[model samples]
Target: MPILIVEDDNFYAQRLKEVLMDFGLEATLVNSTQEALSSNIPLYAAAIIDIMLPNDPDITGISLRESRAGYLSGVALARRFRQKVPNFPIILFSGYFGSFEGESWARDNGILFFSKEDGPGALKYCLQKIGIIREVKPRVFIVHGHDEHALIELKDYIQNTLNWQKPIVLRDEPSSGRTIVEKFEDFASSVDYVFVLMTPDDIVRNVKEDDKRRSRQNVIFELGFFYGQFGRKSGRVIVLHKGPIELPSDIQGIIWIDISKGIKESSGDIRRELKI
Candidate 1:
């Protein structure tokens, strides 16, 4: 896996680079915000960024979820790549942590957020984001709850039945214990499209537990991290709702996922959602 370390400090940046190399990964170190952007790196499994780069931008690159400028910062630019090319992970690091901005405003404009001073915290977060599986199977997390057999069956259909690339199904494995926000960074960094594997059970579980509140919160807070750090959008998000849903409060209202009734019917829906 390749990790892009974005920091202006040679000592710290080099230190991080060496760590990644020692751990069987490639590291590309850059010392300035300008240089980081100019690289136009095609894709990266993870990125370690300095949240407070001297002249990076006034707007929160570490918390952008949506964009009005369409194209703003290098981090913001990464979103375009993420939609077309998923699996690229991004880490927004800073020696300091900052407070969040407006909720609705942050959602429409922010995605992911992080602080750099966690003591290799950024690096650790990056590694976890790109789950280090032993094999080379295409990693795909079936985002459903317990007893999501339909999802499992759908997965089998896609792989064993349809002869599609077999994806490493995401279950309650120890690795999945990592925070979803961190995982999204990895997915955004590396995967092309996140199959939102939703089902009636998922909707039921989320709705019963006020998942709408949580999902909305996730969109604003977590999504802001990606928006600010990697610049992702709702367009890049391919949603598969088990049932109809309301745009939760805040920016969740901006992105819409089409709903489907069953497994077989859902497959084509996702294809259409991604416009594949």
Candidate 2:
């Protein structure tokens, strides 16, 4: 009933839906050209169509079980849709936009072309150009330990100061009958960035040294999870180290702000890293 999306990859399609939701828009998702053609196109405002798609046997009458020609079926689908409605809004969203053969055709026919690499902000901008109102917010996941005060301050900064959506704190979220890991993942996978709080919440001593202050084990694990998911160089993971906490040696070069004094002290660096 909002935007009709035609994407073949399930993972990418779900991610696109999440991004649209973050933009305060709802989307009806269809997996193939056949599905899109069958939908009530007139009821939707616009369509975000993936350029590379598998052949829909229902429409093409040819099986693409072992064929590569179906890769461009989205182009043919767009052509058919254009014929049906000349002025209908359409966006050709693709991961391979640079190498797509129909780039010129899409431009010539007045279709909006967007690359997956350009990210959700650009996609929202494209929809806006087509007269769709979008309210965008950064989805942030905060990974903290027993530092309740620190967590509250961080959330306040993100919500009240930065004016973004409420930052996700796993423990404070409703479980919804899911295991802790499942609940954590449900929030983690959708967030655009992760803020790890390295607070001195635990004291541990190894055989080689005296007891040292460290973050809770759970915090350490969650930090590793985010690092593994987004990688250290992506700038998606921000570490706020508080005090002289014992950090894992393997993650030495990760970008971190010394929040040992306070979150306000590192507010400038936080904004700069988040690119707000």
Candidate 3:
């Protein structure tokens, strides 16, 4: 099923949308409980419903930790949906309380309740159970030179601020770190995206010598490795030049988003670009 997302608050709903994209499923945003109840959600594979609605009057229940309603509101919602749609898989979410009575309620009603505290992990768990698996984010590899700081900042933005899943080769898993030759061997063909920061520092430092080509050699090797590895799949690579080094013909074909000059506004820019 597709994923229908019902969130009362605008910001929370938007955040859930980004998480869904990573799973290759886009969420349908319904603002109010009325909108959610009125609309047809069957087109979706699953749904994310915020239990505590603004106009909903189950005030007797405790408040949710993140929002105003607590465990009780979620339980009521879960119970209500289960009675109406017995077969449909429904996800109940609450930001209010850590102890979600929703799970017990869901078990009774044959629905699933996820705590907001678990964050994406909860969503990931839910997706896994439903058998949706694959990498939706562009696997980006940044070959750093002296200006590694800029790359790191951008990486952080992508991971932390942007909430994008970046499998950083060095940072994420260093133990399995293979030689540069091994890393780029199969990379180009499999990689959907690549960014080459052809800055003066990167190029000048990586310059080749007869016996010892330093930083320049490293950059060249990685680029060449991708060129060859990608082989027929070379069109997916993105080559970003920092100063002026021309991309080889193979990689030159791919489209690129240049962050060499730097992003004008990080948080807002990314959110706007991705429509978070």
The estimated TM-scores of all candidates read 0.41, 0.57, 0.41
Q: Pick the candidate with the highest TM-score.
A: 2
**lDDT of residue 154 for candidate 1:** 59
Residue-wise lDDT of candidate 1 within 1-276, one digit each (tens)? 577777777897888788677668788887655566556566566666654343334433423333323122334444533554464555544453232221223244333334343234334434643563122323343444343665676578557744546543433333566685565555444432244443333232454466431233333343444344423443434444545444435555443444444556556655565454
lDDT of 2 by residue, 89-201 (tens): 88887776343465556777777776676556457656766877644677789989888888989999888988889898887899999999999877776676789899999
Give, for candidate 1, the lowest lDDT window spanning 10 residues: 97-106
| Greater-TM-score candidate between 2 and 3 | 2
What's the best-to-worst order under TM-score? 2, 1, 3
Tens-place lDDT per residue, model 3, 103-166, is 4555566555565644565566556544554435555565555556566676776667646568
Q: Which residue runs does candidate 2 get wrong by more than 4 Å?
A: 1-135
Error of 3 at 124 (Å): 1.1
Q: What is candidate 1's CA lDDT for residue 109?
A: 38
In model 2, the Cα lDDT at residue 25 comes to 80
TM-score of model 3 vs. true structure: 0.41
RMSD of each: 10.6, 8.6, 18.0
